[model samples]
Target: MVWPIDLAVLTLVVMVAIGSLMVKDLLGAAILFGAYSFMMCLLWTVMGAVDVAFTEASVGAGVSTVFFVGAVFRTSRRTRD
Candidate 1:
């Protein structure tokens, strides 16, 4: 019952991770990573860990996304040859 749901969440996280790695654009990859964090946070909530979920949602989705975007801004959006 609960195990299945957990497994699905874990699968989603893994898929998002893979997508993030495979993405060529840095900004797009960062967005995917943020979405991954959001999914993981939801999974945590589903597992009855509200505090962990909150932290993950805030830090992972919010803070991490901001940092990644800042890094992207520091560098050019175009890829160099």
Candidate 2:
């Protein structure tokens, strides 16, 4: 396991996580969440957990992102506040 690569991916995961939370747009947040999940998948792959990584990529990044985007599309784009 290369430490630098792991660290870079880890940093990306953290940044994406924070960006997902900070974004005002729901679709943008969902996209960031997908990116965070993909980064986590890479981390899992680096740790030799191919099965877990596949699950994260399929479920966390793929299905959930689609669900979030679908739900976002059904809602009003204007802010409630």
Candidate 3:
């Protein structure tokens, strides 16, 4: 892979991560985290790690999102801080 592409992906991942962390809403953060996982899966696919990408896509994007949403529903959306 070329350096530019790698850099771009890395930048995207970092931006997503930062957004996830900075978001006050748990649901929004969860969605952004899922998006981060998807971008990471894309990067993995580009690196020829199909199996890992599949797992990340399934677990990170799907399962984790469900878990986060469920947790959010079980609790409150508002945060003190």
Q: For candidate 1, give the lDDT of residue 42.
A: 85
RMSD of each: 2.2, 1.7, 1.3
By TM-score, highest first, what's the ranking? Answer: 3, 2, 1
C-alpha RMSD between model 3 and the true structure? 1.3
TM-score of each: 0.87, 0.90, 0.90
**Candidate 1 off by > 4 Å:** 78-81
Write down the TM-score for model 1.
0.87
- Candidate 2 colliding pairs: none
Q: Write the per-residue lDDT of candidate 2 for residues 1-81, one digit (tens) a residue.
A: 778899999988898999888888888888999999999999999988999999999999999999988998999544432
Residue 71 local lDDT, model 2:
90
Flag the better candidate by TM-score, 1 or 3: 3
Candidate 3 has its poorest 10 consecutive residues by lDDT at 1-10
Model 1 worst lDDT run, 10 consecutive residues: 72-81
Per-candidate local distance difference test: 0.90, 0.89, 0.89
Query: What stretches of model 2 exceed 4 Å from their correct place?
Result: 79-81
**Candidate 3: regions farther than 4 A off:** none
Candidate 2 at residue 28, lDDT? 87
Which has the greatest TM-score? 3
